[model samples]
Structures are given as C-alpha cells and as structure tokens.
Target: MLLARIIKSIVIIIFSCILLKIIQYLLKKLFEFTKFDTRYEKTLCSVLSSISYYIIFVVSLILILREFNIVDVTTFGTLVTGASIVGLIAGVASQSILKDIFNGFFILFEKQIQVGDFIVINEEFRGSVEEIGIRSTSLRDWDLKRITISNGNITSIRNFSKNKMRVVSHVRVSYEEDPMKVIESLEEVCSIMNDKFDEYLLKNSEGKSISEFKVYGVTDIEKNPVGAQYTITGVVESYRYFSASKEVKLQILIVFKKNDIKIAYPTHINVLHYDNDYKNEL
Candidate 1:
C-alpha cells in the first residue's frame, strides 16, 4: 500500500506540471484572440500566471498529503486550524515577504508600472521590466542582465515609456559661420526629418501629424573649440526616441557637409622657444 501511494504521488506531481503548461498556453491564446493592448495583455498574463501556479501548487500539495494518509476529510478541520496557527507565526516571522506581496498588488492595481516598460526603480536600477510577479519584479538591463527586485523595495519608478520623449540634438559649428545661416540649415534639416519620420514624430493638438521641430538657436559659445552650439528639439514617440535621435544627427551631418558648414574641433597651438644662454653654455 505504501509503495502504491508513493507511485501515485509521483504521478500527481507530473500531471500537475503538465496541467500548468496547458493552462499557461491557453491563457496566451486567449489573450491573443482578445486583441488586448500589449501592455495590459502582458501585465494580466503575468499576474494570472502567478495566480494559477499558486493554486495548482497548493492543490497538488494537498493531494500529495492525502495520498500519504496524512490528511483526510475527518482530519481536514484540524489541519485547517493548525494551518491558521502556523500561518500567523509565519506571517509575523516573514513580514518582508508579506510586504512584498501587498506592494505587488498595489503596483498592479495602481498601474504604477507594467511589463515591457523602461523604468528606473528607486532611481537606481534602470531597465526594461520583464515580469511583475506576486512578490518581486524582474528587469532586463541594457547588458541583458536580469535583475529581480522585491516589490516593497521599489520606492520610486520613472517610466520613460509613459509619454512622448523629446529628442534633442546639439550641433557645434565654427564661430565663423553665420548664426542665421546655421539656423536656416538646421530648420531645413528639421523639415526633412519631419517629412521622412512623420510616423515616429508626435502628433499635434489638432490631431495632425506634425514634427514640431525647430532650431533653438545658439545655445552656447565654446571658447576652446571657438564654436557656437545650436540646439534642435523635437517630440517623438518614446519607443522611437533612440532611432529618431540617431536619424536627426545623421541628417545634420549630411546637411552640414552639403552646405559646407565647418564643424568645430579643438585646435592646439605649440610654441617653441630657443634659449640662447643655455645653447652658449652647452
């Protein structure tokens, strides 16, 4: 009988694992069919997956215990009482874990952050959120390193994906160049960028897709390079900021080359002095 019970326990464990996979697959398909927003879908999937896993684990544990003749209908009430007492003790002992779980719920309900968001947690850990679990959140940094932080510890989060991002490019040109001419060239570059990257640029209040890019004029004058720094600013979708910034810089370079505008670079002067007294002594 003991051997038979042990075999059944092992079978139950394997079946539970298979059931979990099937549930997860079904959930993914359901979300895909519903056509929910990407962020909402990801967040719901993660939370629901966690809930399903816990439910399966608890049910499986109970079944395994029953198979061992440790728990049955007759002793179930007693088991519940014992579990309650143990739970109280564990809750007090593991307050941090409880805090994490509660904080996780708040995070989900409050919509402070969601999966796939680029965020800085506690103003320290900056990365893309990979998962928001019941007790912890995982982030994948630029280097692809996964960082798991407890929910309770996340004091602050700066979500860069929440709104349009400003793409600012600063171009330094030789002071000899005309400021107005430089501004005109930058404005031309802006117009070209607007035409080419309309989809990436943010829309205006009139529901029209406009680049809203302009030259900020000479922002600073650098003495070392003897150049005037011009600022170009535009708004683009957060996800497209990096690409938009790169394109703007490239376009600036191309336009400057075509216009024969000289980019500023440091020039070093060397002075050589001949010491007549030292030469005579030698």
Candidate 2:
C-alpha cells in the first residue's frame, strides 16, 4: 500500500507540472512581444505556479497519510491550529507590508506608470522609472541618483514622458536688447535647427520644423541689484524643448553665443580696492 501511494503522489506531481507548463506556454502566446512594461507578469505567473505547486504537494501529503493508515482527525487539528496561530501573528504584524502589496496590485492593473517613464512626484525627486515593486518604485535621476519611493507616499504624480515632453529652458538677458530682435535672432536659430533636424526631427514633415520651439522674450526680473549699478535686469522664458538628443542645449548655447549673449556667471569685481583702502586708512 505504501508503494502504491508513492506511485500515486509521483503521478499527481508530474501531471501538475505538465499543467503548469501548458499554462505558461498559453500565456506567452497570448501577450505580444512587448518588453517588461511590468515586472509582475511572469513574476505573478511564477507566484501562481508556486501556489499550484504547493496544492499538489498538499494532495500528496493527504494521499501518503491515507496509505500509511494514519490519517487521523487529531493530527489534522493540531496542524490546522498551529497554522492559524502563525497566520494571525503574521497578519497583525505585516499590515503595512500587505498594504503595499495590494497597492502594488492596483498599480499594475491601472498602469499608473511603467518602466522607462519620466515622472516627478512631490518635488522630492524626478527621474526615470527603473523598477516598480509591490512595496516601492525605484527611480534614477538625471544626476544618477537612485531613489525608492513607497507606494503609499506616492499620492501626486507628474508623468512628463507619457506622450511627449516639453523641454523648457529660460534665458534672461539685459532689458536693453530689443524683444523683437531677440525673437528674430531666435527664429533664425530655429530655422537652422529645423534644417539640421529635418531628417530626424519629425512633426508635419513638409520641410516644416520638428516642432514650433521658439523664444519668448523677457518675462520678469527685479531691476534692483546689490548697489543698483546694473540697470537692465530681466529674464526671458523660452519654451518648446522637444529634442530627445542633447542637441537642444547645445543649440541654445550656440544661439546665446552667436547673439553675443552669454550665460551668467558669478563674479566679484573690486575697483582699486587695495589703493582706496590703504589711502583711507592713512
């Protein structure tokens, strides 16, 4: 009888393995070849497979007990009671962990954000979505900073790369330059960029620019200075930044350089400081 039960358990285990393999094959054929939009797909599949696998093992346990003629109610009651106590303790102690796990399930279902998405949350951090787990989502910022945010803390989300991103850069120039002239110079720069990117920068495609990215003249800046020496103080806000490549920044740099305008740098100038101080002291 023991040998017969062993054979039965082995056969059940083999059948369960075959069933799981079939399910896996069907799921693969169902979803198209899309890269890991979510880590939970095959991972969840494996979790399910493990659960099913355990069910088979449990059946084997019952069969083996019956074969040994020791399938008694008292033994079953002892096992169930111990399992219940352990489960109760785990449920109480792991509420937060369970919450994260449930939230992670919703995240996967709703597709809040996926890997390789650019998102900003709470002004605390912004970067590419590296990994989204049940507990936390990992991000790698532009500066190569890795941050993990819990699913609970992620209330507000700003996904910039969902469709297209507007790369905005602001340029502040002296109020002396004509707003029209600056715009015109920028338009010329835009013209050049349009031609250079015609092959790659795509929008309407009829010799048109990639996208209508242009310079909006001076916004606002405080005229007041340290000692009121600098008269023309203002800021220009430029919008429509859509270059996936790093060429946009370079183009802006060249635009400023060609226009004889330079990015601001911090410097302190003292006029005859030593002589004046010495003379005053004397």
Best by lDDT: 1
Cα RMSD of all models vs. native, in order, equals 3.7, 8.3
Q: By summed lDDT, which 10 consecutive residues of candidate 2 come out lowest? A: 227-236
Model 1 has a clash total of 0
Residue 121 of model 1, lDDT score? 95
Global lDDT of each candidate: 0.86, 0.58
What tens digits encode model 1's per-residue C-alpha lDDT throughout 1-282? Answer: 999999999999999999999999998899998877898899898888888888898788778877876555468785785567557767786789788889999999899888899999999999999988898999999999999999989888888887688888998889899888889899999998888878778887886765577887788885446688999999888888878899999999999899989888878899978799988987
Local lDDT at 243 for model 1: 88
Task: Give candidate 1's TM-score.
Answer: 0.79
CA error at residue 264 for candidate 2, angstroms = 4.5
lDDT of 2 by residue, 223-245 (tens): 42311111111111111223433
